[model samples]
Target: MEQYVGLDVSLKETEICVVDGSGAVLARSRVPTEPERLAVVLGELAPAASVVVLETGGQSSWLHQELTLRAVPAVIVDARRAKAALSCLMNKTDANDAEGLAQLARTGWYREVAAKRPETRIIRSLLLARQQLAKGRRDIENQIRALLRGFGLAVGAVAKQRFETRVRGLLEEIPLLQDAIEPLLAVRRTLLEQSDGLEERIRDVAATSPVCTRLMSVPGVGPITALAFVTAIDDPARFKRSGSVGAYLGLTPRTHQSGETAWSGR
Candidate 1:
């Protein structure tokens, strides 16, 4: 008889449950969260397993790739949907969750999530890092502006290069202000350098990628935006129609309709 397996994955370990076609629990066990270890355990416990279900999470992509390499039929399910289905049960322990996931797989009632390729993840990480550094730089600039304003000084409409010079010129005679603002200025300068480096790296990656180049052909779409879209989508074929792309990006409005009444909101 074919068996279905569910894996409730945590940071350190995974709770595994195996069930027969009729949803009867055949085995329960725990193994380290590493995919190799889980694959070995599953091979022994459910060699005839038809499907293995796991929820999408921080480690899901890596685990999915590893399991596929080991010839395991692993499926990554939408975590939100899986959580809703599992909520029907009273108990919510990891073991119980694993059992519920196994039942989900046995019944084929879970949404499968697409795992992006490693290349896409790398590009996405670059974009995210750049965004963080840029935000940090802006925050520091704003703080400096606010601090200067407290002393009745306004850093009015200056370029980034002149920002430090203008602030220093304003506080040159004020020793206490100079001491207080120097460290913040140093941090802001470092952030600026790092942000520039990340931007160069992103542009280089976008320039080299054929997909990113094509995406950039769209009017007003630059390297960063193109790279972000390409990495986020990962696979264009995943969308059945082009019109669904707006909804996927959360650009479409939400609609509510009941009987004859209808409403839409952003």
Candidate 2:
């Protein structure tokens, strides 16, 4: 009397259905997508459920991690593959998708995607935040450039820190234009300061990391870039070939060859 569960999860609600071995519907309902609430619902279902199926999405990793700790069999199938399986059917809905996923699980016709390790995920978040700060700083610089261009003034290739000092002198010569740029420069100063702070924090993290220290020993790599690369990789052993390191950075050229046609260097 083994049962199987399928969950179609969204931000606000989750549609769930349980089916027995004979494809008989046991229970079906919607539940809140919060981890604790979903866990409670799962506990209420038959304990003998063989497998629970969920399509890949943002919350799937969290749900999978929680279920693993509880010793529940949860399978996160690839969304594209699940959709292809469902596309063959005439009608589609949340319930139908859930049922299809459950049946697919039972039939052993699903592909599992890898979930990020906790440490890797944390480092990735830091890298993303650093990228945002960098982009903001660049936007502020572009604003300064655009303002200078409007006045037909070219402060050619000055250092980032010195550019402001030189620009201020030019601003005094054109009081009208200076009025427009003064506020932007004030905001730019704040943004530049924030970017410098973020960079220092990132470097501090790298300074303490043994992995980053080892990575920085390589030629043509600096501490910050080395740390970024090492932290992103997390586990070097996961890659079968040493060459994959360069490939991951997109330094290697892609290639496709046939009997008569060849394509490479992309």
- The candidate that wins on lDDT is 1
What TM value does model 1 have? 0.89
What does candidate 1's lDDT look like per residue over 56-120, in tens digits? 99899989999999999999998989999999999889999999999999999998989999988
Per-candidate clashes come to: 0, 0
lDDT of 2 by residue, 242-261 (tens): 99778756788779898999
lDDT scores of the candidates, listed in order? 0.92, 0.79
Candidate 1 stretches greater than 4 Å from native: 149-159
Per-model TM-score, in order, reads 0.89, 0.74
Clashing pairs in 2: none
User: Which one is best on TM-score?
Assistant: 1
TM-score of predicted structure 2? 0.74
